[model samples]
Target: MGQEREQRPVGVRRRTLLLGAAAGAGALALGTDALATRAEAAPTFIRGADVSWLPQMEAQGYYWNNSSGVRQDLFTILKGYGVTAVSLRTWVNPSSDPANGHCGIEETARLAQRARDAGMQVLIGFHFGDTWNSVGVQNPPAAWTGMTYSRMLDAMYDYVYHSCNVIKYYGVTPAWVKIGNETNSGICRPIGGVGHPDQMTGLLNAAYDMSKQVFPNTPVLVHLAQPQNLTSIQNFLNAYGGNGGKWDITGLSSYAQGGNVPGVLANMQTIQSSYGKPVMQVEYGGPVGKATQVRNSLRAFTTGLQGFGGLGTFFWEPEGYPSFNGYNSSAWDETSRRPTAALDGFLNV
Candidate 1:
């Protein structure tokens, strides 16, 4: 099991210390007066991997694929890599886009089972689309295309219920639940997008409401697309806040060079200071070749957020298998011998 990533021993006491090993504590040593400031306990969190590779593309380059089963081996590898969480995505249905079966419920369930069997947390991702989806593109799954808004809500609830029920049955409890993938535009349809400032809160409320019903204690995460639109991001949350559409966490997707990392961190500071919640850059990475640089590039973001009250971050797919290469060359090719240095930042090996 010894590799670049180190497996945290089981039965060892869990540490409550926040950012115990944060990168730059050197400069703080000289500033004795810094002690007087409010020492808000840093929230402890898990650094995790999303395992979003297409199942059939084993040749692609996800590091998780081994002989027995990619799902099982992926869990072991995550631990080996010092990651404590596994994110599973739930799509209303499947698509033939790549392998079509890549990260659908079928694969997620399998991965969840293995993760729990291996003692890891699961973060469930629900993409309300038939094909691939994200904040930038959230068209409803084809199955619900003609359905009205009311019907859509019903479908949403049913999907939520089904997801929770299925995962629970697998004996894999999710530590965090993302109601929808980056919801910057809105969920399901363009109508769901927050066009007018007034409907912003209402739309987010209705969406967040779905999670509250089934998984009351589970923290719900609201994610925005891209890092540059900080002002709009704050405004959207404020609107959501009006409807009591409170989420336990605030997340942003900052792709490589999507925006200035410092600007992104500043926006997160506002989220922490004004909104008062743990922040995370939910899905982030660079182009295929730039994965190595991502680790170094992202360091500033984490250091800037030090003591500002931010939760851990997740690099989109660190365990992807190159053998299971995506249809396009843009993704990390898991078929490669090992993950690129982008993953090394999280592994800290």
Candidate 2:
């Protein structure tokens, strides 16, 4: 799922670390120094794209071309355009509805492997739903329905831990892990809904704890959409962290269009300053066909982040063409089947 406007949207690792003793030993050995080295060597700014739809697109015979007019793999085209990372979304027991299908842990792990093979870092986004999970809806996975709150907590922990272990089995350790997608109203409704901050934070902390247990080095992020709405973000964080919630980074979904880039960036700065945590634009893009405006907006947003405590920005579904989904914020040119100049915003940032 790769849609802008709070709609459809869009890792692996060490061997011998799966078992009980070995995992503990590996965790002990993977201390602060190893993690520090990775953090230090990473690029200062992350230029990423959420190509969660790549597999389905390719399965349906979609192809892409590089700037030189030569057909190539999507990953190759993205790399050629300065995409340093890829974001893949995963669901639990998802349907098989083409555009809304797949993305189970197995599929996601395979995709993460593909990203790793392409030499790009990975960010695994857990939707915790069978379909779309966003600000408007937070339905629990089918399997988790009708369970008691205690059982739900157990289920969440097991899901996250199992998912992390599966990704590790693919030999890909993600650079970042997102607990839930667009949890502006909280995740896994009723039991863990926004109105119940205690339950909400319980679910978040469970996911965070399990994520850290598996990949202690990777930063666990808590995501909320529409950062320009400062009050909403501040309230969510206040309720979350204020109620003992845990998060390593503050992830935001900023679909800044045109002149709003500066305001969005300022809000992001305020978030970082307010919480003393690094902020990442985990999702952003412009309307289709507005390559010039999109490029300028991205340039301004990323440039501003480079000067502040910002970690990265990911354009949602740059590979999506007009005929793909109903989505229209993609940066690909339908006729040329190549990226528009809009992607140049990531260059040198």
Candidate 3:
């Protein structure tokens, strides 16, 4: 009941470099501040590297099948792949303290350390749940189960503070953060969800206020589900005064790329324009199943997203399959063992 609609960000990106044509040559190597500022003054482009789910996998030594050799250091692997940052999702405390949860602040901090060791910026995804969290579902960490509204808000605050402080404690403040992932239904739904403009605005205001207070230097992004919801996203953010109006960068979750990378890229341009903010594809790209396929899609994806209000992107979870076991078994990868074509897209430019 927050709003019965969907939205997407917008901008039209020509294959040709719009502003910094000469500078926007290979990949991020040439994507310096001067180029970004120049593009922004007129129109900017997104140059990013997706290092989300690789570190832990490499460390644990599952199939991994990356291009650098199955045994190579993943960080070295990441830097060579042209990845400037790594994204990881935090499950609060997933498994019962007794159940032995998977990802925790401590685990994420360790991963962040590896990414930092490779000179990569870290994008910590605070999933806001004690377990696997997503848009259709936004459960609090189990510890906060059955809490009152007043306590719930405090719970959220603690979650934010704990996540940020833990990362900061190790001195790896993320480049950008999403309060919730694909909040197509709005965050903290049902309990303190906003069904009216006034209420939604207050809800967003509170979340944004906490984000700004905690991570002022690092931008906070509010994410929408997909391109189809671009407008509703804009409307909600504008009404709520979050990203569309003030949040630093507009973030998106594009599941379309799997079917048509170009279409997905085109949609990103459109959404970026609509949102009127630097764009970040917080979630996109996934296991292509074949190295050759990865190469083809990644190149087109790289070309399409360049020079048209393209800020950056995190390829969702390039290799998150292993952690999921048989349930998301497809998520696990085969052992091609050298930086996969997906890795090469950012690596070779």
Candidate 4:
């Protein structure tokens, strides 16, 4: 889930609010002033990055330095590049891969604090499984195997609630929360997979309900990869909603290298028009040299979804991690160890 790409021949990877109220007289004047101030304030456009590999990278003694030659952390470098938000993914138990086991709740919370301190909004992605959950893999956690469907649903709710509480304990609330990563086939597996639409919807609702209980104000996103597969996306959402699945936002993953930007833009428009939910390009990346093209694609996506509650875009690991598959096209620039034009796309947007 952290690595949003599919394994290929050294290539390929795909991946608000307001208030009101008032009293009388002097209180009314104060309320009016506050409202006026809020109305006058410019709206925020989210430029985000998913640094789910940061903890492990730092644990391995990797360090990111600023352009000034001063040593800095990943979050600091991201902020300097005009990234306004950071997304982190969490696993139920990453002990299966100890070296990459830094995605537990505590580690994610620590990273979330860093992003928050850097003045960037935080997004929490729950892969649900103990490891990767994508189109090719959506296995349940080792601990969740053999459980009855009912029990699995209960466990989902409990896990989400507990994980969210831990993040809140760290004094960092996520601006957005993804119930599952690249869940085109559905979350968990067998019991929660697309084959069992009812069970899938039940499991999703369980997680979504619990997430809202913990962070009522945060928007919950239902993420799916391969934005070009509009039919699959439409079917999934149809089944989800038909079976009572609910989501506050529609999340997408697209890669310019895959040549799906046009389809992705069309899908975003369809989601907004059909579902009336905000659309977010939660994950996107391509070859560093085509940064300008990627940037234009994102700009078009944002512009299309803007009026229909579009939130903006997030690049998935623009600063690629060698431990992961090490796709050359994904990272900003390997030599400089700093952001390249690929990341500048977001800044420019």
Best by lDDT: 2
Poorest lDDT segment (10 consecutive residues) of candidate 2:
5-14
- Candidate order by lDDT, decreasing, is 2, 4, 1, 3
Measured on C-alpha atoms, candidate 3 has an lDDT of 0.56
Residue-by-residue lDDT tens digits, candidate 2, 1-349: 1121112111111112234434564454355336434443456688899999899889988898888878998888888777889999999999887678789998999999999999999999999899989878999999999988887887887788788888988899999999999897888998888889999998888787678777888887889988889988888899898887877678899888787888889999999888866788999898778898998889898899878758888999888876878778888888888788889888766
Q: In candidate 2, residue 245 scores what lDDT?
A: 84
Report the number of the highest-TM-score candidate.
Answer: 2
CA lDDT of 34 in candidate 2?
Answer: 60
Determine the C-alpha RMSD for candidate 1 after optimal superposition of all C-alphas.
12.1
lDDT of each: 0.60, 0.83, 0.56, 0.72
**TM-score of candidate 1 relative to the true fold:** 0.75
Can you give the lDDT of residue 245 in candidate 3?
30
The TM-score that candidate 4 achieves is 0.82
- Candidate 3 vs candidate 4: the TM-score winner is 4
State the lDDT of candidate 4 residue by residue for 90-114, as single tens digits: 9998873534455888788888987
> What does the lDDT read for residue 56 in candidate 4?
70
Give the alpha carbon lDDT tens digit for every residue of 1-349 in model 3.
Answer: 1121111111111112234435643442233334334434644233344444454444555544445355555555555556666677777766533113456777777778777876777777666667655557756567767776656655565456555666766767677666666665665556544344454344444455455445665666667766655566656565655422335566777645345776667667876676555667776565546545555556566666665756665665555553433222122245454445555555444
Model 3, residue 314: displacement in angstroms? 1.3
TM-score quality measure for candidate 2: 0.88
Off by over 4 Å in 3: 1-70, 96-101, 192-204, 242-246, 321-324, 327-333, 347-349
- Summing lDDT over every window of 10 consecutive residues in candidate 1, give the lowest-scoring window: 9-18
What's the CA error at residue 214 for candidate 4, in Å?
1.2
Clash count in backbone of candidate 2: 7
Q: Tell me which of candidates 2 and 4 scores higher on lDDT.
A: 2
Residue-wise C-alpha lDDT for candidate 1, range 74-135, written one tens digit per residue: 56655655678767677777765554445666567777887777888778887777656775
